[model samples]
Target: MTVGVEEEFVLVDPRSGVTAAEAPRVLELLKDERGVVAEFLRYQVESVTGICRSLSEVRADLTRLRGRVAEAAQDAGCVALATGVAPFARVSPVTDDPRYRRLADRFPRLIGEAGTCGCHVHVGVPSRAVGVRVLARLRPWLATVLAISANSPYVDGLDSGWASARYPLWSRWPTVRPPSAWHGTAGYDAAVDGAIRGGKAIDARSVHFHARLSPLHPTVEVRIADVCLDVDDAVLLAGLVRGLVGTALAEERRGVPLPHVPDVLVERSLRAAARHGLGGPGVDVLTGVPVAHERLAEDLLVHVRPALRATGDLEDVRSGLWALTARGGGSERQRALRAGAGTPADFVARLAATTRGGDLERKAAQ
Candidate 1:
């Protein structure tokens, strides 16, 4: 399967989570590696890898890309952080980028205040029919994936209490939640057209559903997960996504009817997942009973196990999940670091160190 990865990273002062739109300056220092760096917000830069079929290749590409970016940022006296939201990001700190300016002008209330980052994984679908089918099957499991990858807990200098505040915040935009069930490509195109004509959106590209058929690519894009700081976490999440899509495709081949879930149940389940992480209460979307989030996660994992094994990624996926649960996601780690350091600035400094790729090398060496 062809896979592509896009990671959004925050540019911040080494000691502060505040926005540092110094990406342009840092890019200048790197001699402009085309296809490697793309502009996100003024305060963020995104790195994308070309299509690769193997997990090992993906990991190698990402490690090289991240290391290069970190070195460039260090040369420019800045650091890049991989997280859903920087704790100190403020609307006023957004850099003056033309696209961002347009966004601010168009959706003043929403775009002006938005500063969350995320990772989007796009796996190629052989046809548009497959794309829609994969998206439909993917919708029900969005919340579980979001919970497993909850990395953004603090926003605007305080804990947002939600394991991934980026989820709730990103859901504010119109057409930005989970995808609705559409029967085929024609139905999907019609829906996009109607939304545009009815002023619900500007164009087909604006249909920013959490898991949607990519207008620009021949793939279904999974956009709900946070930008994980640990490279292992990011890789594991991508592997799971690949497995899920593969399973959905297999089910489609078997002529399995796509399950119809109530929208209200999906929303409720997502909210609970965001609030509790894996340690808190999670609602069973099928039954609406409150249960442990970890149990729900396990059930979801079971459904995707065959796919995981087929992809030869079950071990890595399980190991990565264990690492997150044991050491805590980015939020918990940030909280622990803050408690020990006694200041947000200190915590951010530690985060910068962690993201520099040096920490992983040190761990391996030890």
Candidate 2:
């Protein structure tokens, strides 16, 4: 199976690290560029990678795409953060476009409150039937995916006391949550059609679940991750998402039934992930049993091992896991920075450097 990645970055001033509503300037420079687009908020920009057959290709695409974005930001007197949220982005101006204007007009409060960057991985599936089955089986494992991708611990200049504040901050929206198992393609389509009748969702793109059958592509979209810091972390997430999809497709092929996990328990597990990430306690999705994050992560990797091996990504995934564990996931590192730095500037400056090209330049700057 091939994988594609979409990363959303927040634009910030290079000096003070405040959100900069300068996407117009950046987008203008990238007017002829492929794989780059403006997001809902002007302070946000998204970059996409083409369908790739290997982790090497994903890494190459990310490197090239991020380099271009960093150059554009530099030219525009801004810096692009691969991080999930910034202290000042929630109040940043909405993009000046018909769709964004319509949304702001319709959901005034939400428009004012909403703004977060995320990483989405799309893995190919054979058909809608396969995709639906995959989605059904994918729900239980979704929270752990989010926990591994937890990078949003700060917002409005405060540590939100959660490993992933993005979880709760995003819950304010009416439609966002982990998906429920559906009977089949028809059931999934019917639920989506029913949702749009109320006008909360104006189009197919509004089918916002933690994981969903992509309306515009032949892939299952995993939308549970914060934009990762280390490029390897991003690649690791893409690999895991593909593994999850591939594993589910295998289960569908075997005619194994999706497990019947209770909705309340699923929600509880999700909250646990948001609270502890891989640093403390986590609730098991299928069993509703409490366990350490390490155990949960182990179970996750074990569950998807076959798919990883099938794709020849087992080594890359394993190495990435080791690196993330050793260096710390973004949430843990961000918290440590705040704890140690005498000022946010020191952290933001280093964060800006890391977003450009990871540790080499960041360390050189220091």
Candidate 3:
């Protein structure tokens, strides 16, 4: 199976939360690279890797890609951040592009102020039927993943009181929501057709479920994670996703029926995850009872261990999750920095310090 990742990063002014339209300039510098591209907004750029089938290869590719992009952005007098939302962004700061402009015009209220960064993992599936099955099985687990990886804590100059404000804000779009449980390909196709015919989305391709069958690729796209600041974190996330997809496929082959989770319960779990992150308690999708985040993560890891071992990624996943627990999520680190500095500028400067390329570190020391 082939594994790929796409990360949307924000180009921020080092001192202010203002968006920078520097992706074109940065892309020019990285155009010679293997897997870097511009995102929908000028302030955001995406980095994808060539097909990777192992953890080490994925790690190397992601590390190199991030280093290159960080170098380019620094040269342009801007710094990039991997967060769900910038703490001080103003909605008016989004660049004036045709697509953005159209979105703003059409959904004046929602689109005018919805710039958020996220990471997406795409793992190839053999067929649409497998993709649908993967989506069905993965739906209940989405909020668990989100809770463990909730890195967005602030937005638009205020504390959003949610670990991932991006999830809630982005979910406001009429067409975007957690996918409904589908029995099979027929049910999946019917759902897509309804969404398109009702004018809720542009086409079958635009169904923005938390996890979905990628219309443009022969993969299942996991779209629930916030952009992680550390390349190691991102790589680990990619590994976990690959393992999960592999596990789902195995279950299908074993004739295991996908678990059923009610839509309301899914929404509630998502909210609980966003609000508490892994810091406090969250609702358990399986039990419908509240439980500590750490316990839930441990349970999840056990369930997916076979897939992890099969891919030779169990160690990476275990180590990465351990590191996160120790260092805390990006939101926790950002909060600590903010408390110490007492200003957003200082917080951003600290972020820039952490995001600076390792290659640049050597040059700067001279």
Score each candidate by Cα lDDT. Answer: 0.76, 0.83, 0.78
Per-model C-alpha RMSD? 2.5, 1.5, 2.7
lDDT, candidate 3, residue 86?
66
What's the TM-score of every candidate structure?
A: 0.92, 0.96, 0.92
What's model 1's overall lDDT? 0.76
On lDDT, the candidate that comes out on top is 2
- lDDT over C-alpha atoms for residue 358 of model 3: 57
Backbone Cα, N, C clashes tallied per candidate: 0, 0, 0
Lowest lDDT sum, 10 consecutive residues, model 3, at: 357-366
**Which regions of candidate 3 fall more than 4 Å away from where they truly are?**
91-105, 356-366
Looking at model 1, the pairs that clash are: none
The full ranking of all candidates by lDDT, starting with the best, is 2, 3, 1
What pairs collide in candidate 3?
none
What is candidate 2's lDDT per residue for 156-189, written digit by digit as tens? 7877878888788777766687787887888888
Report the C-alpha lDDT of model 1 over 1-366, residue by residue, as the tens digit: 778888888877766667777877877776667545645366677888778787777787777778888888878777787778877755444456565565566566786447788888989899998898788898778877787777888888888888888888888877787778888888888878887787656667666788888888998899888887767777877887888898899899999999888889888888887777766788887787888877877787788889888878788877777776777766676666567665656667666656655665344223
Question: Which structure is stronger by lDDT: 1 or 2?
Answer: 2
lDDT of 3 by residue, 100-134 (tens): 56555656676544667788899999999879888
Number of the candidate with higher lDDT, 1 or 3: 3
